[model samples]
Target: MRTAIRLALPLVAAAAALSLTACGDEDASSDGGSGETAADEGGTDADTDAESQDSGQDGEGGSGDGAEAGTDGSAAPSVDDLMGNWFVDPADPGRSHRIVVEGPDEVSFIESLEAEGDLCNRGVYADGTLTFAPEDCLQQGAEPWPDRSATLVLNEDGTLHVTWESGLEEDYTFSESEWGTVA
Candidate 1:
């Protein structure tokens, strides 16, 4: 469907980072996305290719903050702008729902709930919205996640606005850059 195609990258990397770490919540949803929750190692190359093409920005594009710097309300933030960590209200950030965006088309929408932990979903960035399909979402090693979808928008204050397929809306504040913690 249109929703599936609109989704792109992120979950692939996030799953590797959060597969075992509990985020402190719970989702009752079960596996239903695409009904084909199988891992396809064959698709790795294609994902890499797409990420390289979408991330054309170098080290000098923005203010160096993980969040987008420009205040363009009419324009959607680029994939580079979305790359990093976002989380719901939490003092330590490790105890809430999180979104980790790694590239132009890859987005990992992670929940605090154990049942619906890290969902690596494909995302399409268009018209200021990144639409994602979680049905086909996977963990790092192709671990399957429940079927779902969500719409994401970056706010002027550098927060993330997400509306789940279940009609739940939540705002996540920009955390730190994923790169910062790698070392």
Candidate 2:
């Protein structure tokens, strides 16, 4: 009976130690609950999904940047600002003309010079030099028009000096009153 009690005592101690270890593990797991772990992961994923959705919406709405609408979205060139659709001499009906300046690269003039109607063409202005060319002028059967280039210099005193080389290399100074905005 003494030997059995000795063995029984050690068994009981071993059981107690096992129980303590199991309890400690349970407490650690409870301190940092599984529910809290799951919630943290779910919240992170939800935030990422929301950000991706917002980015996708922006791509659909033209990138959500106004720069694509204009050069810088600050100010855009207008017909009035560029001297569009103006009569050379409004007081004299016979000398009236129409000018359509499109953007910074194209200029079309409809003067009252001939019945074939003033030509419509494209031109470029750079470094105070303007060059005008008729549409498809280099193509076959195109009219053999004279030098269709012109140079325009804007004076500081609100006047424009226009020089054309169509057998009439003449310089004309136009006042602000002779030009009007189109729109």
Candidate 3:
């Protein structure tokens, strides 16, 4: 049962991404893999799913150690807070990527490189961090995009940072699309 849920999460995330394609400026196209990409159109403040509505509410206490901690003494960047479209920081855009996080368990990451590709992963969120399943579980054209590493952190300033098992790190700020901004 656990394995089934794990596999289904990415599939569900992919379906949710389909609804988001219309939000992009570029029409959706196949990448010959499970990954998908769309043109940049910006994000809206709209809510795409019920889960988004409650993402801001922290279920647990905040450590107040990071910038994401609530000034009011509450927690910030709750699990749901990481949902939405996150873009590469314009000031330092490299290998442009737009990551759409859907519920607490699924994410669709669209990266625009010389060879554009995207990947969907089933993961979990806790302590202001999001980690996806291993690459073996998510394949793109016979290979996983990053077969070893998948981790993300949400900074207090509403910026996002991602680290791959390959030791690559990236800083990202939220992108706005007609659909909505990255939560």
Q: Highest lDDT: give the candidate number.
A: 1
Off by over 4 Å in 2: 1-81, 113-116, 136-145, 167-183
| Ranked by TM-score, top first | 1, 3, 2
Q: Report per-prediction Cα RMSD to one decimal.
A: 13.3, 40.1, 11.1
List, in order, the clash count of every candidate structure. Answer: 18, 0, 8
**Worst window of 10 by summed lDDT in candidate 2:** 53-62
Report the error of model 2 at residue 149, Å.
0.9
Model 1 segments more than 4 A misplaced: 1-75, 113-118, 138-147, 177-183
Give the per-residue lDDT digits (tens) of candidate 1, residues 13-33: 445555554333223133223
All models: lDDT? 0.46, 0.35, 0.44
Query: Which model scores highest in TM-score?
Result: 1
Per-residue lDDT of candidate 2, residues 29-115 (tens digit): 335323222113342232222222111111111112221122222222222334333333333323333344544566554443322
